[model samples]
Target: MAVPSGDQKPESYYVGVDVGTGSVRAALVDQRGTLVAFAEQPINQWEPQFNHHEQSSEDIWAACCVVTKKVVQGIDLNQIRGLGFDATCSLVVLDKQFRPLPVNHEGNSHQNIIMWLDHRAVSQVHRINETKHSVLQYVGGVMSVEMQAPKLLWLKENLRETCWDKAGHFFDLPDFLSWKATGVTARSLCSLVCKWTYLAEEGWDDSFWKKVGLEDLIADNYSKIGNQVLPPGASLGNGLTPEAAKDLGLPAGIAVAASLIDAHAGGLGVIGADVRGYGLACEEQPVTSRLAVICGTSSCHIGISKDPIFVSGVWGPYFSAMVPGFWLNEGGQSVTGKLIDHMVQGHAAFPELQAKATARCQSVYAYLNSHLDLIKKAQPVGFLTVDLHVWPDFHGNRSPLADLTLKGMVTGLKLSQDLDDLAILYLATIQAIAFGTRLIIEAMEAAGHSISTLFLCGGLSKNPLFVQMHADITGMPVVLSQEVESVLVGAAILGACASGDFSSVQEAMARMSKVGKVVFPRHEDKRYYDKKYQVFLKLVEHQKEYAAIMKGD
Candidate 1:
């Protein structure tokens, strides 16, 4: 998306900073959700070991400062009303003096953050699930290894001496950003309710904590974790502090909103977009009919309801997690864009494809899409993958199955190593991700969600192939937000709310987000997609069977 013209100015503006898996992006968004200016910076990520992803809080915050300063560069500082932050729901460690603490055994305090994708807590998550606690119901009957409770347990068990014992605060990355801005220790409901096992209606599940053996969290009245919570967009303790203001190149007393997990911010930006007159069935249905799929490196499918609807192996039913006064159910695919990149870049024909793509001034995937069209002849592009199938759980299945033990599987590999093969393989990976979304939708529908449309944003939504594949495979229309960087818009909405420019988040959502384009499902291709989906299911079943046989029972 292009930045807004310098000549056209809105009455007021909000600054949004989003820290995703690999980069930090900041935008200056006007009241209408147009990004006036934007800047981005890459942050550091380390693989201390396999499945053990680590990032430095210092590095992340520095990136945020750099981008923020750039976005607000020529704008009148007085016109900026508020600031908001959104980040991956990773764990941040700090000591009592509010200093970063080592999260790993190597004792490097700089790398105090455990990233959202880290799987070092697998054993802890399994043990937590084994308890069969009541709180599991809210998390779709099983907790994935990615949640904070399990990660905390892992720290206490394995890094007790270096990390856990000295730790005075455990902040979700979103909360960490807010605290840095306003010096407020309160956590966002989006982070606590969705990531930690905090119930909006009844506070922390002390019994669940005690049952999971992380009862030490209970000792300080949950101070180590968050004791006080605020809804996303609520004004935090006196807006940006003096030091933070100087660092971000913003005013000291501007409003600062409590933050949200990055994907939830994306949900807030797109889920409530005004879709009237779009001829979508969702236009006549309740907002709940729309599922906001935030597709980036990974993908999250967020559905909201007036009443709680429990979907097995999904994530929520958490109140006020994404949308206030609405119960949200989140289903997810752990790796969508990442899986596509892995498949494409690892192929033997990657070098040739890259050279051609660079010459055309297009991304490798874009060139691959063009190549598929060139080779498909009379059939659909998907037909290129008729003999090749990919089960895209290279990084364990995150939803519907909720099983991290599950491994990726592929069928139909050929001896041919050419551009045609690479293009088809790329198509298969995108199709596999779309299939994963279909599985998630099926699970949600079985649990009583009346979903009618999909609202999409983030990196993958920009790809026509990915968007069309999802629309065709899911048999639903995909609505693209007028603002491609809808997550930034969502973050800016938080700031708007906190600035009191909008009375409510719902109101801000309505006023800010707008539908740009709608991609309808191709019913003609439905028959073919249906047959492939069957193969997708059978592939998983056969994988489980293979595991059972390998056990030699």
Candidate 2:
């Protein structure tokens, strides 16, 4: 990647840093959103126990510095105009002196991050749900165990001396990154409204806080969480601090924009792609007709509207959460890529299948897909999933049903431990995950979302079979972004907005994002999937019935 000529001004370059569940990625993007250089460094996560995941704030920041420096090496550091960050909405705990505070019971302060998937606070979440607060309506009327308040309450109850007494600040990871960069403690409304129970319209709900036994946060006037809330693209105080600038190997005063949750950044990156010539509904209709699907370890379905639409079991009605002034309704599958990995790698024939894949210079998944195709060819009629079905809720359902206790269900399993069987299971798993997306879309439409096109990003979008499966299952055209890392591009847009490169996020999105290709549904396969979807629904309905009978309900 070559740097621009010296005549180009310093404000021409922008940096977008994204902190995912396991890595911190940095991209050097131009004013037009072209990525010049990019780097990534893996961060450590500890699963001390089942359902408990944690990370270190000190370590994450160290990685941020390492990757940012690596990405900008040999480039004119002075030409880097602004920086923006997006991160998983994990909870970060720190002491008054900015030392790590233990978010776990073992008193290991280095494990200060309560990961977004951690369910250690399940009991706390249940207790909070009992309060029946009005603020809960925004979060689909049921606060998740994944949210910060429940985790905070759990820490306060179980690790009171180690965490509660010593903890002086609580931050969503995005805000934590910004504070680390600029020494500014203000939080972005994007993180607060989306993760924490900070209502955009009503601000922090004091009555709800008191009801949930977290009134201490309210007592401090919410300073520890965030006293000053700014929009996603607003500039933080006084740009980057001298100390941080030195640490990052950049100039002292580049703008640092308020941040966004990682998935929301993905939404911003693709949601605004030029649909004018694409023949999509967003091309002829309003922006509300498009749904942005950010697929990775998890998947979030983002639908924006002019008015707040409260869809039950969805995550929002969050005002200006993604695009400013438009409400965001976020639905998600807690496991997609993770589920596929579990399904494929956990099989008895995985080692042999992996060996075959290595010999062919193909991924194990690709090998499985090929084997599934062979099996389909052998069948005289019907599809690969003619009998097999999978429920794909190994990590629990995050949307539509909001059922965390739902376990994965697999039907049509044979005692044969052959690679072909593994392939069938793999195909079934893919179809199941796609069906889950369809279920979310159906639920959203039932509640008034006029979704017409599906825009996808992240790791799963690269898979041809997965992309086609989503298109086929949803019966909607799937649009891919020209920039492969749309999440990174989205984060860069924030820096672009803060540097005044664009007048607003809408303009920044329009200029910086572009569509690459479209995957249309296989019209001939509609009946095949429709029948399979019926079996998929029956698997869940049957699971519910069995559970009810066992409980004598």
Candidate 3:
């Protein structure tokens, strides 16, 4: 195992900063991986138009500063040995001196970041996919609008004068954070390989760029995007710069690890564990048999194999993208928790549900879970919405179809707008999302990958109903992480690696990440969900037919 040289004292504490869609969070983590203290501050976002989402890099960094200072408040500065970052795979636009540049028509540099959920690049993504370049093979044979290149293409064609012409650097959001801290221009393999179509073995595919009509990127040997790329755990240059050190309230020259996408960080936090007593069938199997579901605003299904497994519509088969020396195949739903929010908040019964939840001192979701039981009246919850079905592609399908043109669909709705209606619709949406997972699993299994377990983390995993629905629907045990904030711990594991406290990322994962509880599949509910899964598939199929008919095809 190759380790960093010139190790001095043992690592005492490391900080992990996560820049999620809604907020920036920092955790002060001990060497044992326990979160000692944490702080969070919500960042700003803008939607100047439809399908557009933007944020400020400067604002995100300021939030990072506030949270980092709070997390390390009472600790000795010297005890903070290293820091790491993980963020949504958003695009950050910058000019030559590393100043922010606008990514939208408003021309405000403060709104420079194009969030991962932004879909302004749909037309650009369609054009890139039309090229069908060989590089597309690494990205599930389709280019998602969420990825960087399509967004880059959009800048070139739409905002050429104001944004693209003056652009000097384009970064995946995580890389931008690392560069901010360390003054390094290097990119992480995790971001580039997974989102930017940079092959780990072959580097940039100039042909793909040229074919897609963005040949300018290759003109100077890919300098505008990135020329130097490092693996996720590798330490970046000279640690924290004096400016960043003062901003983060830390000592100068502390180690900074190359970062991962937030979902990948969640995967690192929960996927690998010694599952001897977990009552999971996968306990004795190889890690390849376990799938990591990092669920929150969006959900990514991360599966690894000793060799490449090319499941259609799933992004990856990328070498060493997540777990080193193994191949990663990531399937995802573009929206999950966000979808739940959209459905519940848009319902007429939302006010009533909110009032009742507040009266019970419970979350709306928690209140709904209990309400679901009452509505079921001794019947299985899955049977309550027997006639209603949902196709959870409201934010566009991310995997197993990779079709962005698809919209959300719901069937079997009545005229009533009561609380019961809201609860059942929420239940059906969660079930639809779970069925989407089952679809991805079926696709992977069809491609010869044997996955027997589901490992879950992130915000949605805290919901017992969501966890149980996944297990009951998939007929696989769902393992939860002991740490609620596994994504932060995963980022800290990167710091531990850079600090030389562990020999490898695998070692760090084993030591810091552990299983909390296992929700096993209920055999009794299996047949019921099996029938519902058939309806789930049919809903999507019928949706496509409706679109065809509407288009007069």
Candidate 4:
């Protein structure tokens, strides 16, 4: 690792590590939030049952080390002033010796992680929801199976011997990463407020825990989970421990900040873009006027306000989860990018389409976009999805609806096995996902949020059609950051805050992040999208009616 030729300050470089669903990524960023180096290593995931997803703590940490080492390969380690981490809200189970504890039904102790997407806790979630506890208000009056409590309850009921008896600690993935780095077992307020049932104003509701039948956690002073909570971007301990430093190939005692959930990091990365001159509602308005959409395998819509607002089916009013001192309202889609992938790749023409894509040196999505244009010309309306519609809930709805049992739907399918049909289906799928976002936006607005601009990041932001569709559907300007991987940049902002380079998280966000492009809603496409939106609602309504009839409701 060598320093570049310049008189740059020693504290210019900061490191940010993000543990995503499939990979661990590391980035070295400067004071200006400019990424100087980046690296990634895939992590392992295990699916032992239909609704179970698990991973290894050892494998994840190893991948983190590999990526951290690679990103700093040609950089000056001494200049690396601070570090921060962000990760999925997956549950990590460990024993008294800090060894992995089996989270699966089988006795495979090496699979220590219970992924956030695992739905084995559905029954538990339903039971918890049935209680009608006051704490449920903060979580949209319905605790999702994706949250920690349901998953913990599932462990207690199903895998009593392997999980319940042996589990000594339950760390949200971000907190686990921080504990590994600094040897501090304190949980992050971001994770607790957003995922776990910790209320910022009243702290843990002991009654809720007891009623849920897992009083052992409360009896133990909640030590196995989290006894202490710190806000995102707060400095953690003195720095990295000697062992963690050795593993990461970095110097000991460098500052390490408390962590954020991955999607919130993307919110911190893009939501503060300078919109004053952009003539958007977020320009001179409070952060509440802007919504941050982190679109990846899933999508999270984050809005912050100084005062808490309780919106049904939205996952917050969590205090200080993203921006400090702001109450966050989190709405999301369980599947966005993943749904698009499934729709396109699962089609009959996939093989021929993929071959055509490769021959043109294009991504399958890109090739499909081009093919969609050709299909539109063949249609009388010159629009690929004029008669087609899709409900983008292949993995269940996460927000506004919050119905995990609801399945996906497709309308206006013809008996054609042509690539044009596939392309139109793809276009319709993308539009459906965007419309889902609109549904969330409308829900938030009805609950008193005046969101006028959307800050988008992640894989879906790279798709022009997707981005434009979001703009047209939501009827708001979409702002994208200059740095494509704003999640990593957001993590780096925490590092900068920890290093004392910035006095506060807000200052770091303002200094490091900048907006690159803006997409305005297309006025001409308004009527088309509106008509399709009505169809989208009808599809869901019809499905609900069918369910009611079948269930004798």
Candidate lDDT values, in order: 0.92, 0.88, 0.91, 0.88
Candidate 2 ranges with C-alpha deviation above 4 Å: 1-11, 378-382
lDDT of 3 by residue, 1-553 (tens): 1122587654488899999888998998877778989898998989899889999999999999999999988677878778999999999999988999988887899999999999998888998999888888888888898999999999999999999989999999999999999999999999999999998988998888889889999967899899999989889999899999999999999999999999999999888777988677887889999999999899999999998888889998889988889999999999999999999999999999999999999999999999999989978888887899999999899998999988999999999999999999999999999999999999889987899999998889999999999999999999988788999999999888887878999998888888888998888988889999998888888888988899994
lDDT of 4 at 393: 79
Model 3: per-residue Cα lDDT at residue 288: 93
For model 1 the local lDDT of residue 423 reads 89
How much does each candidate deviate from the true structure in C-alpha RMSD? 2.1, 1.9, 3.4, 1.8
The lDDT of model 4 is 0.88
- Per-candidate TM-scores read 0.98, 0.96, 0.97, 0.97
What digit string (tens of lDDT, one per residue) describes model 1 on residues 438-501? Answer: 9999999999999999999988999999999999999999999998999999999999999999
Which pairs in model 4 have colliding backbones? none
- Cα miss at 522, model 2 (Å)? 0.5
lDDT of predicted model 2:
0.88
Clash count for each candidate, listed in order shown: 0, 0, 0, 0
Candidate 3: where is the Cα deviation over 4 Å?
1-11
The residue-by-residue lDDT of candidate 2 on 1-553, one tens digit each, is 4554678644478889999886899999886677888898999999999999999999999999998998889887777778999999999999988888988768888999999999888889989988888888999878878888899899889988878978889999999999998999999999999989887777898888788888898866887788899999899999999999988887888999999999999998898878777666668878889999998888899999999888999988899988999999999988888888888889999999989999999988778767766777655222777888899988778898888888999988788999878877888888899999999999899989999999999888987788889998899999999888889999999988887778999999988888999888887888888999999999999989999999994
Instruction: Specify the highest-TM-score model's number.
Output: 1
